[model samples]
Target chain A: MREDRHVVSVRDIPETLDDSALIGHSLSEPETFAALFDRHADEIHRYAARRLGPELAEDVTAEVFLVAFRGRARYDRSWPDARPWLYGIATRVVSQHRRAERRRTHALSRMSVDRPATFDDRSADRVTAEQLQPRLARALTRLSAAERDLLLLVAWADLTYEDAALALGVPVGTVRSRLHRLRAKVRRALGGNDPFAEEPQHG
Target chain B: MDDEIRQFAEGRPPAPAYRPEARARARELLLAEARGGGRFRLPRFGWQAVAAFGVTVALVGGVAAALSGRPQEHLAAAAGATQSAAVAEPPAGDLEPRPGQFILVESDTMYGSMTMGRNGEESRHLYRTHRKIWQSVDGSADGLLLIEGREPRPWPGQRELPKDAEGRQSSLWTTLAACPGAPHRSDYTYLSTLPTDPAALRERLYTAADEKDVDRDERAFGAAGDLVRETYLPKAQRDALFEAVKGIPGTQVAEGVEDSAGRKGVALGRTAGGTLTQLIFDPATHMFLGERQTVVDERAGQAPEGSVVALTAQLKVSVADRLPDEAATAEPGGGCPSSAVPPTEQPTPAATLSPPENVTEGPEPAVTGTMTATPAAPPAVKRSPSESAPAVPESGVAATETVPAPPVAPTETAPEPAAPGAGS
Candidate 1:
């Protein structure tokens, strides 16, 4: 009878369970959802802040998690990770503030960067990037909201092509083609010079 | 990652880390939702909803009056008043405004306002304003709104007054334009045409243009409060409005609730998403006194439980013979800079007034002004016996237990209606 007992103590449930298991358990124990929030809230907040400045990001981040929690029952448990689903929801949430995002990018484009003396490769790279920010922001403003979303999910959120496709609910091929076209447009915007073209290539 | 993409990421301005307080607040709301039997309820009194409502109202026209109500002690009194065969009369005097006269309404109102700092921190405070408005008895002429900003009250958990709240003593006068097709809903001419039967009025209240995300019952209850708070209604219409309020499911009465000015009254309140909006009435005369909104659950509203986030005291409503000199000189589009106008009293754009979509929706609530006023024959004043009968039993238990008992309810049903309303 002691060997047959099936009750698991709270301590016995490992914290390392993947998101799918946590979300599955949360159906019976709703507090289990908080662990998911703790795992993803920082990255979600950072992604939202990068798009719409910090002030509006606070609201967007909160809304994203609430919407995710409410719709958690419908989540596909086949996926082991929750990042794609969260980023997908985040894409929609951030889209609601399209005007704010445009305003932010346009504001950045008009700002002049003051150059500083560089001491190392990292600082030099940073200085070069700062110099290119004006054109980069302007190029971002010119992209359609969909293109901007896909570009940023890969470029900023660091999603792989497959994950970007998952986040945007598109076929992976579409991600590759869109990125190819967007890179060309951004390269053109940078006066046909790629900032990293001169760097030593690494495998 | 592509080299160009890598540079793009590196060039991005650094985002500030999420504030711990904000994170905790969001967590608390989530936990509360989980504890609430795992059903998702739209956040009650969410800062975003309130801020959005304010912005929507501002874009549509100037600041509309805040929504209000109180709970159970008043239900018993209201029921007692309804039993008698005698027609209910206005408490002070004849509230009917004669044709060509203006209806002057004065009130002290406090509502929550939120502002974000440059660093992305949000601060909330209760902005108090003294508002005086005069509208023509008929909706033919423009109205005037004179709002004077008062000292703002600190919201619960506020450390110090935000810079946005400082030196807010300036007053501004804005002209409430009565465009060719847009009639003011609260004007006596429009209100007099409302259904006098409680059930019909209640139905009409429900069918108004729905505010996105607000529960229908809560919207109707808030609409009823708006109709009575800053406008004068005839005795019969006022009586019908009060009676109709009982038909709204989830209404609870609070025996003794105080308005902002310290006047004691019985309050009829309905709780939704954790905030209880109460409409207070003079217990003796049943005259609508004011409105109060209290956070009954801290988790949903992100405030201390029992915190009164909004309050209004109706000081006076009387007939006036003429407009002030300022009104005479006020142009249709120009009077005061918008910054000078209290955030609540910005002039409404004409598009919100007479849109075809609004006309089809139904009569607009006096505050949100989402519908057009249709002229109907005055409703019959005679109340049938059944209509006058108490809708809810005068049982003490029903009143006490219907909703979360407001934190202010005294143990001994104190004879004096003076229960200090919480967190005002």
Candidate 2:
């Protein structure tokens, strides 16, 4: 037990020390750990901003990677891709700051009218993306927090509902239903009979 | 629905990385905690205690993949199999396809545990116990139901329910018809949406039904436990469950696979967690078969996965007996209870103020060190002798005996005695 305590101690360093050994180095190596943060900080920052807005985004992003690094000891080594795990943590962090998130989204929607194209600046190949911002924001506000989270994670993060479920820690069934309800609501809001406007429409 | 909304939000590419210096500081903070020298420590769980918790109900039942766009025929087959396993034999060709789809459902059945000890018994025993039934109808849900087994009687802590005319329990139909999205009507017109508060939303549904002078909200309130509990789970946990299932190792859309219902559907890949989740749908109707979630939690740093948690169920769009009521098509004026009616019809927005009034006031104000506020305290302190003694040490110690009033009058009636060494 004494030896085990020392071993655990070496594994449990603070932010001042480097714990990143990638399975085979002295846990004291800080440079190894810096590589992980350098890789994820900015993308996580952008994701935080997109979900929570610019002001709260930076802090939330920092907190996210900070958490990820702290919890890295518990990570399953068999899993190589860390994006899903990071996303899962980010989802909760975003939720904790929900009020801030809502206010930001509301503000963004209001501004979307001026820069409608920026929200969905898909290539000129698609005409609908250009014209849909005002109507989309209105539709966006009608959705429940859960609904909006599921939708936006997919659009911006490009995660499938299944991947999203992992990021969200929810069953896929919930994801599908939220999407369905949200799509229906948006269609009703927009009065857009264009089948493609809704999800999984059979043309 | 979630997928559709997400598709619309299409995210941008990753942002540029932060400079190396910032990354180094963050690395140090995490390592300190890792070394156990910082403020954080990982929570400890006894291996036996973990085993005793049984499989997490949600993790086990989440084996059912939430399906989309499946044939009705396949759904009937799969649902029939699952139901038959739990209950009686299912109906034949009851597997026939139908319209609409299964939106979502609660995945797990959580059983509460209890430890009982005899008066003189040295050892207490814990047992696996059953509570309520919860299932999600579709992938986007957490617990499909909030309540289980028999209508709950009202209690001190009981949540309020909506009721119908004749003082009966109300349902989804009666409440939604006249309410115009009563729960969320406010944001709806501007964004055309509904409110998210379950209680407020319930009231809106009730108000809509009451427009006909009916008491739907009241009736629903009576049976609310059944309505909401039918899908109860903490909102945050539910969200987490969605994220977890999505992260299961190796989860991907399979081109062609047969689900429990034997429907030809796309497969979702597995995850490192060893949970297999897939979506099966009918090409013809786009109806959904419930999800199949297979979960395994391998012992950390151990070679073998320890246990298997499997939960599967089916969700279909069934005709709710209570629907086609006013909630489906609430025409104007059909439900306005006399008191609630006037404000609703005039096209003016009705103010739905429903917060409790008796918010408690805070404790007496703390004293600030300002000289201007000192005079006000003396009079208040003097009136209450008991308080003044402890409050004003300077004045109390100076006056040994009771003192008379210090009066200065231009037209003097009498010379007031200076009590307690006043003359000295």
Candidate 3:
């Protein structure tokens, strides 16, 4: 058992390297970049899927890694985690399909109003949230492309304000202010229900 | 801390499960770029970007070819040819354009267009367009491309027309500059200078530079298609082109293939990556019709197998004395910077020999036929494995004895340096 553990540890060494270190090594050994893909492709795909839909998520995921691999030389080595940089490229790629995004949001805003009534076991709070979906989707369609990008980068991608700002190539202050305005607008659209007023109550 | 904004995640349409094939293909493309040992340049223009999209789809189907160092040998071993024995005499044409005359080509085309949403959802459709181009014979003056968008059709499995594609029927025109040092590739004078012998022409076709990330055989096949598609080739050159295509290792014949214009014709096709590009020819007359590309294998995040991703139908090819007056009033700087005109001469204003109305009213020629014949015996050329096994009627009248030797070493011919910003 101890001998097997030693062998496993040795094999796991390359996988343990930070993105910055892996990127640095990839300059000399291009295959090392595959580690980055393996590490982040799923999360990136999920985030893109949430934004664009599954069909386009595949392309977005592929394009993000390709763009990242090609631009690895210019990757800021100081940033240990590559998530922000990857998200930044994803943001740009998603922006190119603005029309499709608008259409998606518009479609969501039109989801049937009686949908919540169909499910009996759902929690009251969950039901309320479901009902707000139409308003929320409509509100999303109204946001500027940049605002929508920052909102989704935070809400969907789970990026911090700082990381979201990095992904967007904006100062942290901009992220804060824009997010603040976006929350207020969303709150108004939800009829004064402050989405950030309380911690999320459900998983 | 998470906010109610996270609630939007619940509203997201369920994303399709990530396919491992997509991941592998993307990784391979990156590794290939890395192995190429340079900064990867994304295609810069709209059409080139579309071509790149198709290439990505093709790569998904062509993993075996991509992995091999010798793509030509692998492809040659895999490709087969079926030749029909009924030879047709080459069509007669006095296609040579006089000095100052423009070689006008009008065609209808439909190509795949993909758009991804901010949410990561994408829609695929075929964007259709009608194009009219006027090129100077000697590359001494400006050329014009008058393109009008047509209705778009959804790809297979797509239910509704993409919202963004709605109301895209707009007419736009671009000028092809004929400046010194940057000749239009299809300039008649240069095309007329090409060798008319099949063997020599085949060598020239093989020696042309490979398109970025495309294999030598694929590039040669595409070059052959480009030479005949929109440009007028005199009888000798056209005859040689058909014969030269036979020598290309992967060239296959498909019987009863219909072009975009609904004209049934015999097709000579080649597969690269995952796409099958067929250059359709009139079966009886063996006249060039047009070209179409079909997806032969399942592509990642793209059209399904058997989808016609690209299609073109040549409507007319004629000579015009001058470009329309609209060419004179077109926006400045709209012309391609790569003009073919000499530095010493000022460009003469386009002479108004005919009205624009007259130019647009030319009757469409009918080239309709039911191409049903198949030869009982294959030609004497070497054969390999092919996707289309149907035997085609012999179209080209070239002698069967002169099959050129297999493609020579790529190092033998230097790739012609591409002119900057040249439109494909």
Best by lDDT: 1
Q: Which residue window of length 10 is worst by lDDT in model 2 chain B?
A: B46-55
| DockQ for each numbered candidate | 0.16, 0.07, 0.12
lDDT, candidate 2, B1-424, per-residue tens:
3434543663222233443434433444333323222111111111110001000111112122333323323333644555423221111111110011111132222111111122311111111111122221211111112221212122112233212111221221112112221111111011111223444334323332321221343222212212222232222222332233224333355554443333344343343324343433323222233334343444321122422222223322221101122323432111211122234343311221111122123221121111011221122111111112222213332221111111111112222122211100
Candidates ranked, most accurate by TM-score first:
3, 1, 2
lDDT of 2: 0.35
> In model 1, which runs have C-alpha deviations exceeding 4 angstroms?
A1-203, B1-92, B157-159, B180-184, B209-212, B328-424
> How does residue B277 of candidate 3 score in lDDT?
82
Better of 1 and 2 by TM-score: 1
Candidate 2 wrong stretches, greater than 4 Å: A1-31, A115-134, A193-203, B1-3, B11-424
* Worst 10-residue lDDT window, candidate 1 chain B: B46-55
TM-score between candidate 3 and the true structure: 0.43
- Candidate 3 docking: what grade? incorrect
Models sorted by DockQ, best on top:
1, 3, 2
The CAPRI class of candidate 1 is: incorrect
